[model samples]
Target: MKFGEISESEYNEFEKNHPLGIFLQTVNQYHVLNERNWDAKLVALRNDNNQIIAAAVLGSRKLHIGRLYEVTGGPVMNYNDQAVVKTFADEMAKFCRQHGGLILRWIPNLHQAKFDDHGNVLETMNQAAKNNLELAEFQYNEPQKVENGHYSKVALSYEFIKRLNGLNAATLEKSYSKDAQYSVKKAKEFGVTIRKIPYAELEEFHKYTTATAERRGFKDKPLDYYQKSFKAFKDDDKFLFAELDLKQYVILQENEVKTLADRRQQLVEKSEQHLSKHRAAQARELEDQIQHHKKRIVRANKLITRFGQKPVLAGSMFSVQPQEITYLFSFMNDEFRDFFGPYLIQDYMMKLAVERHIPQYNFYGVAGDFSGQDGVLRFKQSFIGNTYEVLGTYTRVVKPITYRFVRLLKRIIGH
Candidate 1:
């Protein structure tokens, strides 16, 4: 097989149908990177028959020591085929060298590693890493640091493969954790609704996302970042939100509480007349429900008074892809988390994907440590699906001194 730079149209046509395809490997993504000041390219490997077997979209940046070329969630190839991986790596090294680049940095979309909670390696995820290092004559040195070797990259993606043929809200509910199921039901009962917002309404999504970042003590991308993302994906992208009508919810809860109170009174009268075991149990359950509704009424009243009659934007999700939808970024107004906004938004996205005939919905980017304590992991795992531990990132050093100097510079820059 030989490697060659392919046109954007050719690469995208191949990528659109590949099972391993992702937004990161799209020509649109290259455009986004280019806007971010990175030089981008689409390269492919062809078999002896001149058919493309693997492809990648790379973005390069000039550093003080040399140019750094990075490919995110690529090259789109079969990592299980060692020969293909090596051939691609050697070709990639030459490509970088030709471009005056010192290294090829990438996190391939290959699932080769699995690990236990304590970080014990269950499978040797070394072939791709070895291929990358050997092609550039670099060593996988100690601690897996950027200075020694590229640090191990881990991301948790919740992937659902089942066709949405027989799926509906209730059936999907059965797959969720009991708490999550209960939360979904409660959110519905409390009148939380999910809606798709057009590009013009993306500012609201950004508002909630930025608020979340501030609350969580993380840096947030500028509004232009989301604007570029929307443009990158074009019509394939969606910005959705779970919203609560605070005033309406308050009224609904008030009426529900009144109805439950009446039911509790009726049950009390029945207990007074019969006092049977079933009657007493019914009375107790009615009382519990009455209390629950009353509490809900109070909560709703508080929210209404605080946020007013407008629909409260509770949480938002940004999704993109042609056949498979991936939730690229999401955030909730943490104060409204009790309304289970995030849960409702996720379920809404799944239903939307299904309605669009998209076969899969991805909850992207969870740490692969699988320690059960990771809140993100736990939340995603609650929805019964597969967790893929993709082959982590690799760096092929094309120029040794330049690579070392770049690593040192990265350290100095606190990368």
Candidate 2:
């Protein structure tokens, strides 16, 4: 087998069809990181026929001591093959050492275990993959307990994924929880429409995403980061906005109010003519519905006054790849929570996944806390998917002396 840097085109071709391909391991990601001043390379190992079998997009930046090399989300290859795994590890170590790398870190896109929504382990997997990497001299970095709980710097260890294999539209819709189905229906009933937006509209997406990040206490990337990503990924990236037309919603509400009032009038007339208690009760129920619709109209008008006639209630970004469709970043206006726009966005993306024949829809990055206290997990659970705990980060020290020196210096400095 031959190991060395390969052209972007060559790497992309191999990665596009690989079973383990992910957007993070693509040339587009390399370009995205390269633009940020990271040294990025597309490296591949090929068999005697010069057919590429294993590949990785390695990115490195100079740390205080030496270069910190990382391969986020992969080196797209079969980890079960020990020969390929060992050879790839050896080559990567040599390459990192030659490039003055202190530590080489990677988070393979391989599942460690599968858990149900309630965090019950349904199946244990990837032990052999871990063992193979260990034999290849890569030290597994087990998830560490931090103040916030289990955390890993390599990548998100837990993900909620819906497997779409052999699922038709009927079965796919059946997979969702009742709440999810109701939310999607409510979104449509509220006149919430979802559409794919262009890169020029990313500023709008950034605005709501930033607000949501602030409200949720998580850091958000700058506008330029998303812009750069969009530029690089182009057609493979989807920026979706779920919008509501306030004028239309208000009109609908007004119509409903009138219809309810007309029905209430009929019931009241009937109650007066027959002195029927049931008719009186029905009239009262209709009156309550009329009042609710009137309130909705007033709220819609207020929203219209604040935002424009049409306002985006939710926005989400997705990474489309052959292997899966990943729901990446998303945010929604809390004030418009009743619109259920985010639910519609998820439904739209999942439908796209099914249409494209993608095998999985990944609702990426949950806190791995399934105690029903985690809001993110709860939201993802509504989609009826399993929790996947991936084998976390692994490291192979390319320069042990420099690594040790850097660790000692950091300790001395209380870093």
Candidate with top lDDT is 2
lDDT of 2 by residue, 94-153 (tens): 999998888899889999999987788999998999999899888988775433433454
In terms of TM-score, the best-performing candidate is 2
So what's the TM-score on candidate 1? Answer: 0.81
Instruction: List per-prediction Cα lDDT, in the order shown.
Output: 0.72, 0.89
Off by over 4 Å in 2: 144-152, 269-272
Question: Against the correct fold, how does model 2 do in TM-score?
Answer: 0.96
TM-score of each: 0.81, 0.96
lDDT of 1 by residue, 210-251 (tens): 887777655566777788878887876777778888878878
Model 2 sits at a Cα RMSD from the real structure of 1.7
How displaced is residue 249 in candidate 1, in Å? 1.2
Model 1, residue 120: displacement in angstroms? Answer: 8.8
